[model samples]
Target chain A: MLVSYQTLRARPADAQRQAIRLGEYQSHTAGLGKGCLQANVVITPAAYALDFMRFCQRNPKPCPLIGVSDTGNPDMFTLGADIDIRTDIPAYNIYRYGELADTVPDIRAIWNDDLVAFALGCSFTFEHALLEAGIDVWHISNNSTVPMYRTSIFTVPAGPFRGGSVVSMRMIPSERVDEAVAISSRFPLAHGSPVHIGDPAAIDIADLSRPDWGDPVPMPVTHTPVFWACGVTPQAIIRNAKLPICITHKPGTMLLTEVPDDADVPLFQKS
Target chain B: MLVSYQTLRARPADAQRQAIRLGEYQSHTAGLGKGCLQANVVITPAAYALDFMRFCQRNPKPCPLIGVSDTGNPDMFTLGADIDIRTDIPAYNIYRYGELADTVPDIRAIWNDDLVAFALGCSFTFEHALLEAGIDVWHISNNSTVPMYRTSIFTVPAGPFRGGSVVSMRMIPSERVDEAVAISSRFPLAHGSPVHIGDPAAIDIADLSRPDWGDPVPMPVTHTPVFWACGVTPQAIIRNAKLPICITHKPGTMLLTEVPDDADVPLFQKS
Candidate 1:
């Protein structure tokens, strides 16, 4: 059954997750699960889990951890009820030796007792707030992935995980930048405020037309290009480390959580 | 040289840490490191580090991680400059099988490549904010250790780390409770807002006089007992887990970081 944005938006978070789990929906989760928190998923072996968690802790803006699964436990019980990390997301990206090995609908075939899953906050939550505040999120309206670039800003090293921050760019009208910043700042888990504004050269990005990841949208002279630390960062770092195996959610496909977008409390406490 | 509160307050955080490292200071860090962030330290072997990190992530209010040392590395580089986790703190409590085995001024003799150090946010930062807001911190005024209790609030389990939350009690006037909460909420790293406010029995505390740790303060009728999730929570949980070996800072003694109390950025980004 094909799930439309209208139909998915009307359903509760668990039902949305259920559809995704059952393989009824397998597409980008944008505009789906309205008002719910969506997370970037990263699964790794127990050996690398500590360092990955430490990397996230050291670099919170780009890697805000919302939930971490118990080692070898496929169920992310703290993230939401009946959340099986092995199968819930729309799609999975399997990386081996730091390269994209394959993309699959679910990870049940590759599931192992030593794997640990992490749920990181994504920009979808704060993007909803921006739109609600009457701020234009250019890429959303243009139907393109938010442009992302590798910046010169180096993330603090944790074990073998270390890399420059990957940032998502949004061009906001000059008059509304502050308002957008304030609204986005409220969702620190969602990459928070802009790390760089106006000048791409300041952060060592040479060109606005080309991005390291995602599609670039039209940049208007009346607007300022704002860059926020992107959740894709960890993936880049993980790839650099050349780990034996790692699994992550495909870009734009996120795990929709029962947690409200504005929840201040940790997800585990809520359950 | 005996470092008085007045003299220590005038010195920078690194200097204060140096004094502690040199054995010139060996008391509670309560009044020291004014305007800087203080942390509760916990060191465990690499085998237990992942679960401990998960436990802290699961129970953030009580275990707000300020810095995590690279596995087998004693220097908490992200937290501050020249932070030798081995000897920077005033005192250390070595626990064997979760039993307090010794109290030492430093852990240099036992430091090994397998140990992972974690610096968690302590109440001192928020306490300072509370005091700045003109709120009376009863324990500080009385020169007593803040009374802490094991509440019925069970922390979300992570591996072997699971126990009820241990909370520190502060008597705030009934009218000022809201103000105190608002002030402390600004410092999420410092245990944030009170977990429980008025009645103690609701959280399963039988008496006000008896505390599991720290000294009991005189309760006044004019003030209501406010409880904030305490960092001692991890210690309690660690003790319950009975790990083969663990090390923690003595109660009241804390690691002072170069990060300012008002800084919202992750500690790693600062240096």
Candidate 2:
């Protein structure tokens, strides 16, 4: 059941999702379904779902919610007519009492009636726009996970959710930083514009060589470091909440949705 | 304590809110706080707050949530430094079992620890933009309420909230419709872009002259009817849900926030 990258790239978003569901593709979903919107997934018990949703609503830059499933429903009809939350994502991170206990391909074994699934927009969508705009996305070009750092910029809290923002870094040529902002700002659901542009120290990042998450890519002298609010923010905040049990898509292996990456629909209207 | 329009317009947002709170002002909020953001208010008991939040999240066009009070805590600190939900809005429409039970200047008597306040973006923000762009908003020019209609467009429902979208009509010069869209699209927190353009019949509006709500203004031959999702939608759907009790700002009277109408922050980021 091995699918070639070329063949997978040629298929539609639903087909790519089907391949992931059937265990045929289980790696990062970077280049697959290029024009499709990919989502960061979070599943929580219905009891805490409201607070978690409020957190996302309060801090949209870090957590732009694209869809929320009906309580206890495994299907995310709003995201896609046929998305199965329990299996479509290539991987799932299971957290027990605010700590990562396991990483699994699927969560069907533990699916329950009290769970709610939330889909959040990912940076990949804007990264695609950046590439199309002729801006160099260093991480994608170098075949590495984008470097992520937890910043001193605290997210506005809601209920049990409280934490600093986690941001992804890209070294953009100083001249193109404005262009990058204009392009990325168009995709608010995808983390929007860079939260910080020049100095990492100002946002409390001690080192560019080492990222709190993902791989660090090289920075050039002519380039300026740009930081965007990362999708991993919700996961970090959820962990801080120390919920009894929570589930999220493994970082970088997101749920590929049918929505086009460039769709101009307002963030709230997307649902 | 009749405050003159000129005097109120010269004061800051907090001062104006204080005036409203003290029963010195009890009229529509248009033209007041010209640069500040105004919001449609909806208050529900804690039991229905989650479902109502989900409804707003699902139907963001009609309910772009700008600020959500922490459960039962009515000082909407995020929206304004001293906004007391019970008294800040000039008027309150109390709905009991889906019926309009009373129109009061304040709801302090019925306020309880179990109620949650939600502030949604109002169209006035964009109408301000429209006027700045030199596009004529007929109703504002005529000093009449914007016409509203219940269209065939069914909102994506959540929990007991199910209803067709309610839209506000603006007859724009056909040539300026695109300009209107571009200007308004920048404010997604406000309804953002028209849901329907041109023929009213296409969206199931039988006549532009007779609206479901608001006063209808005359449409010129050179103009085209454009409709944006109206904030009244949440009230309509909340009524349909027939919650034991609900409270909303009386039509056209909204809560003014300190955030500038033109603030480029993402909708979700505003909270």
Candidate 3:
């Protein structure tokens, strides 16, 4: 299942996206399709789009922009052909005044000409790389959600957006730390490498047992917690700003894109 | 000097910049200060800065932005401390209406509050990486400039910026092609790996002998021409746009910065 350059022509992205559009698929997009990227979605008014784009540019780790829609245009042709932003994802979280108003299956009813959609690189792209390299993801193996925590590191502010970073942690044996770094760093769009390794308190995280989001997995005494800048950081920023309206894809569910996982080629062939 | 993390604090960048600023050294910056990143400078009006930044973002392979200054600011603190964008570089090329106006030792006289500066990742950064990995750059060995050609590859346009990409070619022994690709691919900011390898016709580059810029190097019979996206790409775009005014570093006489050669770090060094 190695997504090599020669094999990228296959169009699983179209079929998978169709399934999502029809509301046939509504769970986590963890292993939905191979050879293509899955993106975190954000929709906001045109007025806030430019500032939000600048925010993603300044803090690339938290929000690596895969594609930005033209004003009032719902089609993100850069990410794929015939893709409609409003109905392409399995679920959408509509926020009003920065608070969650309702969770909907489709944003088509609420989509407006003044709204702009942004597709962000998600960790699922790099997680595929890790699995291919024989690195067992702890939470995935334990059948639980990946643990995420709020860190003391503040994001670079953009317009009204400002907040501390939220990071996702994976506990691994000390020896496999290098493998984790090697596999993950290749996908800079997918948050890149570990921001803090071993010491949770370095980022002001007091406990690994109490994650701010998702289920916590048990770690062996020999394992060390490695943190990566999470896509959730932007959500935190959006929440803090309390803008007029912001719509996003619910966690786990995502907007799949046509881009290959090896957007930037990784080091070494998996021979 | 490997420019390792431990040796980065010595601050040789300041001394090298001072020598350039004093007019003490004016030669091509092939291997000036070790461990620091060298940048291709572009200064334009604040009116065009946003579009130009978007242009760089759209065409990252050709114009990889290392640091973009705050609008109307003459300093680029991201690349270095105490960086005066107008006069720090050894030389500047003033362009008016897409034509060369004057080549000056410093641009302080023309510097204005409406000007914005951009420091782009140069091939010099990756050339250092190649040499460290035992890859011989033909032009450097022959004491000539690397051959550059205007390619048929169209860059993604932003606003008024639009042009074909300009690529620089390096002749390498055919056997070392894999090694060259492996090593250079680590520096995405430095144009990453070869855009076209072996066949120039593939990229619509007709002749390698007669380059549009720089001295042409003799190619060994066993060598292949490997082309990487050149930083001159933005210059071509600027020329095409024919803006009111624009300024850039004279080719080969780049602005050196405190950032590392491997500004985009490789994987697996963490413990």
Candidate 4:
């Protein structure tokens, strides 16, 4: 049986993590816990961990690192209590040698002491902020995934991680563009503001109808396309790197955490 | 021959660089080229470059990375158009096996193809901001160095870089503490905002007269102590790492760049 959004939506992150840990919920986490942050998970072996960390540091816009689990430890105490890297996420997409090898609910069978997990800030927080500010999100209203495109902007590379940037697009009414920029700029952890605005050719997005990933939404005559740095760029780069073992959230199956969605600060620290 | 502050102050960045590059100006860069951002320079061999980069990323409050040179390149084009990292700075402190080997006018003789320079934002930019905001700087008024202390706060470690955070203190009138924070918070590149305010013991400072580095200015009776993350923390860690060779700007001497003293953004992009 399914539960109401009120029942499952605003639960404290701990209870939500408990549900996910117990396998009670295994689905996209878009509306699971309103106002709470949902993180994109990436777990890789120790040998490639530093390189991955560098890649995130070099290209912060696409890969905003919020929390990193200590090497060989499945727990991220800094992010949440009782949060297990191997099982807390709703679903895992295991990539082997750059190919999707298996889709699993949990990874206890393959869990090892050599794995390190990274919790990256997701775009959901900013999307939530935009909606709060009364800006229309075209894809969400139309019941579709935000359109993503591979752009000409080259991400600063580190080691074997090298790729062009990827951005998710939403059409906002021309008058609401400033509000979109101001609201979105407050969430650097959520990829901050748009990487480009107004022109599709500026970042090499030639065709709006045909996106490289996600659903193509209609651009209303009054709206303009706004693009944000997408977290999916790292996944594509890792796949291109042909790492021996790489795991990520299955698109929208994010990990919920107790940390509040701190705006503009990608790496929020308690002072 | 020594030049007057009036001769060099407010000169365009190119003229200042030319003066330094010609071996004419070799002293503390405190008053040189006002309104420009001064950087704490760190050049190291390529072997330890990635680890150092990670260290800066992990400890950004103290080591705000304004610019990073391409590997083996003497040019820091991202920071300035005509920058020659090997010669532009007024002075360089060379470290061999983690020991201070010598302080030189320039590093042209030791410059190698394997060196990488990291230009870190310095607090001088924020002090300029404070002055413009009508806040009197204690050290500048007294003609003394700001007191710095090693705090109990542990910086996030990356690889071999590990150390307690270092902070520099300024005494603000009790009524102006909030204003102090509000103004300083604008310069994230320049150690934005107070890491600790009011009490000295809160961050483990036992006495105002003593500092781990820099000369001390007397604390005023009506003023409360305010501290900001010092860039020296990274230098301390890098020194502790025992790398075969490292080079940095001598304590008070710094590298001046063309970037403006942006209040919130210390990492001012563009030439």
lDDT for each candidate structure = 0.86, 0.84, 0.76, 0.76
- Best candidate, TM-score: 1
lDDT tens digits by residue: candidate 2, A168-269: 888998999999999989888888888999899999999999998788888889999999998889778877899999999988788888777776542322
Clashes of each: 0, 0, 0, 5
DockQ head-to-head 1 vs 4, winner: 1
Question: Over the stretch A42-76, how does candidate 4's per-residue lDDT look in tens digits?
Answer: 88887777668767756667877777776677876
lDDT of 1 by residue, A231-270 (tens): 8887888888999999999887889887778777647334
* Model 3: per-residue Cα lDDT at residue B105: 80
Cα lDDT tens digits for candidate 4, B1-271: 6554446655776787788888777766665657778888999887676567656765667887777776678877656657888888887888887788999988999989888788888888888778877889876765555677888877877667788888988888889889989987777677777788878888788887888877887677798888889877766776678888899987767888877775222333552
Instruction: Let me know the DockQ for model 2.
Output: 0.48
C-alpha TM-scores of all predictions: 0.96, 0.94, 0.83, 0.84
Error of 3 at B22 (Å): 4.5
Residue B26 displacement in candidate 4 (angstroms): 3.3
DockQ score, prediction 1? 0.80
Q: For residues B9-67, could you state the per-residue lDDT of candidate 2 as single tens digits?
A: 67887688889999888777766767878999999988888788888877888888888
Ordered by lDDT, highest first, the candidates read 1, 2, 4, 3
Error of 1 at B66 (Å): 1.0
Model 3 over residues A208-266: C-alpha lDDT tens digits?
89998777888888888889888777677788878789999887677888777786631
